[model samples]
Target: MTRGDDYVLGRGLADSVRLDAQHLLWKMHKGYELHPLIPRTDNMKIAEIGTGTGIWLFDIARQLPSSVQLHGFDISDNQYPSKELWPKNVSLGLLNSLIDPPAHLVGQYDVVHLRMWVPNIRGNDTSALIQHVKSLLKPGGYIQWEDADLVHQYVKGPKAQEFERRINKIFDKAGLDFRWVSDIPDRLTEKGFLVLESESGRFELDSIQECTKTYLLVLREYINGFKKLPDLDIQQMAKEEEIALDQLYLQYSHGIVYNWSPVSLLGRRDD
Candidate 1:
């Protein structure tokens, strides 16, 4: 995979800082995300899927009491914080959730959490993935997953529209439909988990939203990564983005409507 695809925004300190900022936005919108979803986790074991940089897990780890354990797993540990730097209760592992997880990891965690992993996981195979996550949890354990609906991402004005169209093309080529994230609640039900309802909020990457610049940075990464793909037409995409860049300049300067809302669902495995 290209370096551009390494951390979805390049594995750099700048990307890490941007992610931290984005985390604040999510926290502000979604709170800690787990407290309301699950009943408790005082001495519970927790695992995070697709843990990039492991920043979110680290933050949650710090808040958690000493008895609790926080684990994060991903295909790449390139951006993970040094072990020496991690809290004693927090750990990072190199594991891909899409593949068959190791037998030893089965039924280990009291909570299995995944956030913002829509770009990588296939919509058609989400059910199987959730089932696997369920396996990682103890009886009646909680699964708190959060992801945004991108298939219906909205942008206003012709200028913003053009920018979104190009980005959408790249996502389409990648076969990414993060909207399936919204269906996790139902999927958990089908998998025999007790669906626990909760609240969520929308994220608008426009002139008004605070994280617009962060979203722009991510868009740039997509442009760079898609350019390297063998099948996608880089020339056409770049040309469209050229116009889009100018359009975005004007759109974000004034006011534009670009909405990307997220949902957080809770599921409990039957004992």
Candidate 2:
């Protein structure tokens, strides 16, 4: 599909965007110690949900033994050139988790993985999503879910905490749930899967000014939706709040400060 202007994938960007995404992915992998998910055997099947930019799946296909099969699923159809460079074991497909599973994918994966789906999950009934994921897994297969809490619950600095609170309130006003991390484990357990492991960790960036910039740019499109709230002067306040957020980034650009505290929940389907 054509990369339209409104497309949200981190595509058609300056090099810094790519660098930041890679750095974040590397940090995520390190935080999770991801290697154990792959068994010693050469042949394996893995599925990655919300695989934006397709870089992480490509990296896995490159590093794993050639016999492994890596499939990337995203709502967008912007094919990656990196997939052409990989061995034939890699494939990309469209899998919108909010919709019913495609007929062919039902009960056909060894591992199902997802990352950075916080905003999207907020609009979803996660219990339903978990049940859908459970159906896709082969008996005894695993799932690795990683997402930022982004709710300021574990953030340290005062400025960063305030920024997170504003962002959280904005999302809340927009009717998005910012509490997915606190709720996902319970949803998984209720879906009849065995929670193999669940843990959370925090990372503070030298500056998340760039990250905030991207957020404000996107938030501009939705702020109008909040205009009708009686107590909230969203129309008058949005621009001022956005400007203040931008200024905060400017102050921290030599280092914009931000924190990412994500919860990693791993589960296995009953055999």
Candidate 3:
């Protein structure tokens, strides 16, 4: 992964766009209908794994009482918010969830959250991830996760279809089933979690006004991912990707591109 890829569509712009779109999706979700994604707490321990950009955790911290200790951990500091800029209630850490976490963090959180870690989660790691998450929660604590199955999402313009083929090929090779992660309840149950509740919801997007140029940013991500493959040579396609991305934005602006729903799941640690 070159430094250039993470900076695609400009440094932090892609991640920022993704964060904005996710906020709108969560607001529209049914579970969030009764309560906020992160319910109000007086003084509970909260953690978000693979918390990209830290925007969701930041917003949750901002709205919660300062007594609620909030923390976010990710593999890299590349997109993490500056410590000086993060809310006082929020603590940031560098740790890859794919690896064993430090012992001190075990069973320390009352509620743990994960979202959109698909890009990093491989097929075989699915079970191990559930066990690690279960290990992080206090007894009766909650574990919540949200993921989008892009395979079910959108396919509008030719460039969009092109992006789909390439991206889907990569995801397939990685053995990651991204679109149907709402089916995680079974996996959670297998890992000894009490399936408390789960909800699948779609984000309604009529135009680029709602999608916020997210598809382009995601396309750039996959293109960059493809470029990193040692056996693949996509230099020509990589250059064309920039041009195609502009076309995708035009399609989105004109309402030629539409959206599909993302699924969210919630579980409780029982053992």
Candidate 4:
């Protein structure tokens, strides 16, 4: 299993800021934090896996009743805000959702949420992750997963397309397979979670320019961290990627934007 730190992005202030910005972009695109299909109940418990910076929980805290228990868990707590800064109903902790959850936490949540976890998946398999997340849910609990459909990512302009291609190539060389994103529904069903449905959207024209700018900054950070690997070929590719990213960033103002297929799935644990 790959540790969270082994992934490309760094756990720093800049990365946290980028994550918050990226979260907003996703919220704008998806039009909701929690899926509308998820029926809320009084004093329900919600847990977010891979909850970087605890931003999503904070946002949901305002939208839901204060009695709703909102918990954020990640493999690493480096990016978590101070406890004093958290919302009254929000709490942060460290738990690797890829592994079997602790006995105490098993069957404890009414809802389990995960987002942007494509990199954490290894061997193109999600069975273990799904099983573990399922253990955290009570019968009839909902799991909402949000991930980018990178395998089918599109771009409007030629430069943007080339930029995206290079990014994909780098991801391939780095041994990342995001194909599992498109398999979420099937996988959820196989793991005993009834597929409620999935929602997909891209950054529309009005938000494209701003979203692209934020995405480029985050991509640059990914490249910067990836360059630290000892592999020479990856180092060289990362260098070229930096130049490509800069060129692509310049073209965003010219109405060039990469079409990110953000997919969100909501499923219920079979009783």
Clashes of each: 0, 4, 1, 0
Top candidate by lDDT: 4
lDDT of candidate 3 at residue 104, scale 0 to 100 = 95
Per-residue C-alpha lDDT of model 2 across residues 1-271, encoded as one tens digit per residue: 1112222223344322553464355454455334475354577788876666666776666667888888878776554555567558878877677656787888888888876666565454676567667778888888887776665444435665676677666666656666666677888877777887787765434324444444444344334334444546555565556665666656544444455555677888875
TM-score of each: 0.86, 0.77, 0.82, 0.94
Q: Can you list the residue pairs that collide in candidate 4? A: none
Residues 90-134, candidate 3: write the lDDT tens digits.
888876676556899998988988876555554434766777787
Error (Å) of candidate 4 at residue 195 is 0.5
Among these predictions, the greatest TM-score belongs to: 4
CA shift at 120, candidate 1, in angstroms?
0.5
Range of the 10 consecutive residues with the lowest summed lDDT in candidate 3: 1-10
Candidate 4 lDDT over residue span 1-271, tens digit each: 2445476777788888988987887888788999988888879999998899999999999999999999999888899988899999999998877778999999999999998887678778888789988999999999998887778765778877877878888888888888989889999988898988877767676567667777777688879977898988988899998988888877777877765678888899996
Give the local distance difference test score of model 2. 0.62
Task: Extract clashing residue pairs from model 1.
Answer: none
Clashes of 4: 0
Q: What are the C-alpha RMSDs, in order, of all predicted structures?
A: 3.3, 4.9, 4.0, 1.7
For candidate 1, write residues 106-195 as lDDT tens digits: 999998988776656654458657767888999989888777666655566776676777677767766556666667777788888888
